[model samples]
Target: MPAPVRTAAQWAQFGRDHVSHGLGRMQDLVVVKGEGLDIYTSDGQKLLDFTAGIGVTNLGHCHPAVTAAVQNQVGSLVHMQCSIMFHAPYLQLIERLLPVMPHPSLDQFFFWNSGSEAIEAALKLARKATGRPNVVVFQGAYHGRTYGSGALTRSKPIYTQSTGPLMPGVYTTAYPYWHSLGVPPSTSEEEIVRLAKHQLDMLFRQQVATKDVAAIFIEPVQGEGGYVPCPAPFMNHLRELCDKHGVLLVIDEVQTGFFRTGSYFSVNHIKGFRPDIMIYAKGIANGFPLSGIVSNKEIMATLDVGSLGGTYAGNAVACAAGVAVQDVFASEDIGGNVNARAEQLYNALYALRDSPKTAPLVAQVRGQGLMAAIEFRMPNDPLTHEGLDKGTHIPSNIGKRVQEFCLSKGLVVLTTSCFDTIRFIPALVVSEEQMDKAMKIFTEAVQNVANEG
Candidate 1:
């Protein structure tokens, strides 16, 4: 017998009753289907999905090629435990990934279930390969939420609040976020990089010594940390520092991989840049539960044979989807689309920043490729002009207000970091027309919020 159909409100109520309260939701709308650049609500309203399932749907929801690959794989094999045997999809996915990797030196791969698990695996590999006990991370970094990755996440205290005694042997240094450092937006990138380097030096001298540090984990563009891209000079400096101290450099590409940043990987933006280990997940398989770390054969070989296998790590279906994702990347000009859409997004955001009504609230606009953000500062905030009343009182949660406004008008966006910053993570395949529409909705939302303030 068929179950009774429930209205969207009923479904939402049921979810609120049964789902864990800790799992936050941006909206109560019951999403029934997603295609291309839009999500369909249970009540039949369509919304422009600017969040892209939090950067996991880079190729867009249920891309036809990926969908076909997954369907075929599911019919053949769903879950082939990695420890039991090798699978065709797993091997094929690696074959597809090799040529597109940021560097040829990252020749080895280990599949995992999530970005957090991949991060854990990378940390273990780094510790084993280097025989070091400590790991270094930057301030405002968001690797993941699992214990090991949580220990390294410094973007917000709420992530670690009440979670006690996180994985030990983790130290933090400053990332080149001038806003977090209370510096003006005009602060030179070189100065910020210099300050960050000096802090890392201090961490080595005062906290963990270079010899004991196993790896330094970083995001090419900090995702949960206000969409701030690490300066190329700082990235090169980290590479140099890692070389000087034998510290493995782990680039967390969870949110920035798979052409999200107008390249195969965000690290590609830096000249002659290569990471000791690259952690990938998010959009690797569109929306599938797949992630992995790629390192050199030497580093991977340091771990024992039985050290890294997970029961469902390299699920055949997920691997099939991953292979298909790479196939799409090879055949399509997704990277080109990302760059074009990113330019459109930035132009719109910069226009908002320059507008008289929104200028006071627009603290900063920063990002790379389509991974963009607009941070809001209250009128009296130090980041903006103090004592400048813009006719109305600006709320502290202005980002949330803007998000709500967008959602109410059939757009879905997300907030990031500890600041009042809204992130924009549209699918890489979003068309020019779709981007214009999204920008139109987003511009109206910001303008409305600014007016309300």
Candidate 2:
């Protein structure tokens, strides 16, 4: 018998009753289907999807190639545990990834189910390889919510609050984000970089020594931590520091990989950049639960055979989807599309930032490629005029109001970090018309919210 269809309200009630309240949601709409840059709600509304499942469906929802691949793999072989046996899809995915890796040194791969799992695996590998007890992460970094990764995360207190006895030997340092440094948006990158470097140096001296640090984890473009891009000079400085101290550099590309940043990886935008370990997920399989870490052979060889296997690490269906995603990237100029659409989106955002009606509320417009954000300044708060203290930026509801307004107008966007910031992560394949429509809705939402104050 066919399952009975439930009304949108019934479905939402069911979720509320059974689902964990801890899980945060952007909207209450019960989405039934998605295609291209739109999601169809059960209530018969089609909304423009700017979040792209929080940057998961880079090829767009139900991308034909990825869908077909998943269907085929389900019929052929769905779950061949990685430790028990090697499947054709898993091997095929590795082959597909080899040619597109951001750096030639990142030749080895280990598959996992989520971004957090990949992060955990990278941490283990870094520690085991270096035999060091300590790890370092940047302020405003969001690695993941899992126990180990949560300790590495410094985006907000909410992530690590009350979760004490957390992973030990993890230290936090400063990232070159002007907003976090309590500086004007017009602050020079050189000065920001200098401040960040000084903070990291101080951390090494005050907290953990360089020799004790196993690896320094970083997001090329911070995701939940306000979509801040690490400057190239600062990145190079990290490489130099790592080289000088023998600390491994781990780049978390969970949200910045798969050409979402107009390049294979956000780090690729930095000239001649290479990480000791590179983590990837989110867009890897076009919404399928797949993530992995890549490193050179020597680094990977340090681990024991039994140390890094997961029962569902390399699920055949997800690997098949990954292979198909690679094929699509290879055949389509998705990177070019991302670049063009990013330019359009940024231009619109800049216009909003410059508009007199909204300029007071718009603190800064930042990010790269398709991964972008607009941070708002709370006018009534004294912090708006003064420099913000570390981790103490006054919270504003402007982003939430803008988000609500956009949702009312049939648009889907996400608020990020702990401040009043809204991020735009459209699909890599998002069309020009779709982008324009999204921007129109977003512009009105911003204007309406800004005018309210």
Candidate 3:
């Protein structure tokens, strides 16, 4: 969103009066239009976008091919009872997605309207297939907001406040925070690996039987819970554990798929790992409402006919958009572009890490490909060691402030996890020229905010 002369406050007030108060607004910016990786505010200010509409819009806002596909599909058949009746556009997109999937065994897909719905469907499918009610997830993981997905998201208290008496038999355990947990993330890969397996073991021993656990839900690179890349060895071990336990491993790839992580999925990047079920959305349709839960034939077939369907499931326009986006990745160096932009973005963040601007608050820079996070540290107070690393207070504030600084300077970032961190999920099409421009503006904002301190 561009900054108008009247700025965010003026438009914000108008919106508070006119617009519905239900949708959550971030940073108080009013974006009116977008092109490529840049968004223009109602005030006519242009900011380099790092957050691609919360990981949507990976092909960037309104790519011409996707736009044309959507327009063409809308003209043909915009909506259909895809389950009861067949639609060519839907079938075509599904066919396109099959080969790109991690497992050909998981060729069967159930398209939904959003990530949450896809997750909910996966949960239900797993439970039905296994004849089990219990499921497991990590402490810092996020799935989505539907009842089942919400039950597994253990990151934020606010999401659960007064809401939970959520689905029963959903269990959780300490996810590996190897570096912070005295396990040297690199040198103690052995220990880290042991801890992840142990945590799941503890969950099973205390909460649910190994056989009773239907699925182990995970995000390869956790999005809302901070962009924490699940360790490779740990992930491989998890695959083994699931096999031994006869538990399905369901991965939520809503945020990391579609070249966002330099591959179709983080799972594909990690060797010896494949989920029995995987949820994908966000960039799947280039900002359109289309998501899916794809699972192995054995698991997906457990659902009786007509058990799941949606008014907009396999929506023609969205599916066409998805197919076009897939074409872009298949033809262009979109994956390489994401990886290249990721390096540029990471390098920019690191260059600022030691700068007086970001250093005082900087904790760590972590990510894979274009999905990255900047975690802020609790400012150590010598007068009171008690304040250092205090429970979720200091970091969250710093994160918010950093978001404000970025927003003020025409850069968009998102707050995530239980930390003081901002996520960077720019479009896979972000250019080197635009990145250079963004870096300079971002540095200026951080420096200005630092000087204020």
Best by TM-score: 1
Tens-digit per-residue lDDT, 1-453, candidate 2? 999789999898888888898887766778989998889999899888899999999999999999999999999888999998889999999999998777898899999999999999999999999999999998899999899999999998887688787899999887899767766677899999998999899998888889899999999899999999999999999999999999999999999999989998898898788899999999999989999999999999999999999889978999999999999999999999999999999999999988867776777889999999998887564445434444443335889999999989988899998777899998999899989999999999888876666
> Could you report the Cα RMSD, in angstroms, for every candidate shown?
1.7, 2.8, 4.2
Query: TM-score for all predictions?
Result: 0.97, 0.96, 0.91
Candidate 1 Cα misplacement greater than 4 A, ranges: 386-395
lDDT of each: 0.90, 0.90, 0.80
How close to the true structure is residue 13 of candidate 2, measured as C-alpha lDDT?
86
Model 1, residue pairs in steric clash: none
| Cα distance off (Å), candidate 3, residue 234 | 0.9
Local lDDT at 318 for model 2: 93
Angstrom error at residue 102, model 2: 1.9
CA lDDT for candidate 2:
0.90
- TM-score for predicted model 1 compared with the true structure: 0.97
Model 2, residue 416: distance off in Å is 0.3
For TM-score, candidate 1 versus 3, the one ahead is: 1
Evaluate residue 380 in candidate 3 and report its C-alpha lDDT on the 0 to 100 scale. 46
Candidate 1 per-residue lDDT over residues 1-453, each given as its tens digit: 999899999999999999998788877779989999899999889999999999999999989999999999989889889998899999999999999889999999999989999999999999999999999998899988899889999999887789789999999888898766667776899888888888888888899889999999999999999999999999999999999989999999999999999999999998779899999998999999999999999899999999998888988999999999999999999998999999999999999988988877777899999999998875456654433464645656788888888888888899998878999999999999999988898899888877776
